[model samples]
Target: MKTWSSIILAGGMSRRMGSSKALLEINVQTMVELLVEVLTPFSRKIIIVSNEKDYEYISSLFQQALHVQIVTDDPLYQGEGPLAGIYTGMKELQDSWYFVCACDMVKLHPNYLVGLQERLHTEIVTKRQQYDAFIPYSEGRVQPLAGLYSQQKETIKKLLDQNKHRITEWLTHMNYYRIEPSEWQGWTPISDVFFNMNKPEDYLQICRERGK
Candidate 1:
């Protein structure tokens, strides 16, 4: 098993949701909590990168789980976007690769992540291989929310120190991997594994899909 910590990036403003999407409910459980449940099977430790008062509510729910920790970005880094959240999470972990994820990706399959963990053995992988990050692309777009990153304190700090805020811009500076849809054949049961819950309408679609 790959010894890694999973970091859920819940610090985004969620302008589209008009509220903290991380706190959204699906079958009475908050999205973040549900993500934690699925990640427990794969990670040694879990951290939440969040903002706003809602974290208190979320924290109360996970207080018993010793492996879960929550960290909010400093004022300077806060509101800077997902890159800042990713940087904050990587710095928090001492000696493990980070499976960085976003709270919005509600349909993320655990097997999909397991597949990526198995891919960790490739020669293309490295702790300091100059490949600063890894991401998966699907349907013609790079899915930044689902990624695996090394716990490089310097790289994380440099990211926070830089002017680039958008993840795509920063991705251009790093060497990374793009797992095509064709690569996941017998692993995950779900296709479009990166399908995220961006809007309420999408949630309704998931509800419909699940119903069928």
Candidate 2:
């Protein structure tokens, strides 16, 4: 398997949910905890990006966990959104590739991640250099957060320096490998795979679906 690290962005305001969504419980596990569990099987290094206050709380929860790093946004780019989190993680780990996702993601399909890793390995071996990322594209939307990124420290740093913080717009300018919905059919519905608990209603919906 190709070597890689992961970043979990947990610094959102959570205004819609009216509370820290990263700490929200689903299936008896906090959202952040569940995400760590899901990614632990795939990568040895996992970074959780949050604010200083949240970082303390999150770090306490995993004091004994191996290879988990809880980090606050880089001081220079504080509050710059997920793009900053990605940039910070890339700078910290300096890994060849990274898998980034949000804390609000309710389900992460391991099988699909394995498939993505395989595809990334092929791209590396074939010297496919046109793209710097491998992201999911479905229903006319690109899921930037739940994708794999090649070393993009400089690209991300340039965007942060220019005060352009929109992740989707940044993605548009980069050459990326798009994993179409059809490619994810057998593992799970694409919608479910990318399901995000962005609001109270969304959280309730997940609870209901899970028979909670």
Q: How many residue pairs clash (N, CA or C atoms closer than 3 angstroms) in each of the candidate models, in the order given?
A: 0, 0
TM-scores across all candidates?
A: 0.88, 0.93
Where does the lowest 10-residue lDDT sum fall in candidate 1?
A: 123-132
Evaluated against the true structure, the overall lDDT of model 1 is: 0.76
Local distance difference test scores for all models: 0.76, 0.86
Q: Which tens-of-lDDT digit does each residue in 1-212 have in candidate 1?
A: 64578989898777776778888777777889889988888788898988866668878888899999988875678788888887777777665577888897778888887877776655345543544556777788878778787666566557668776777767766677776677753558876777767777877786677562
How good is model 1 by TM-score? Answer: 0.88
Candidate with best lDDT: 2
How far is 185's C-alpha from truth in model 2 (Å)? 2.1
Best by TM-score: 2
User: What are the C-alpha RMSDs, in order, of all predicted structures?
Assistant: 2.7, 1.6
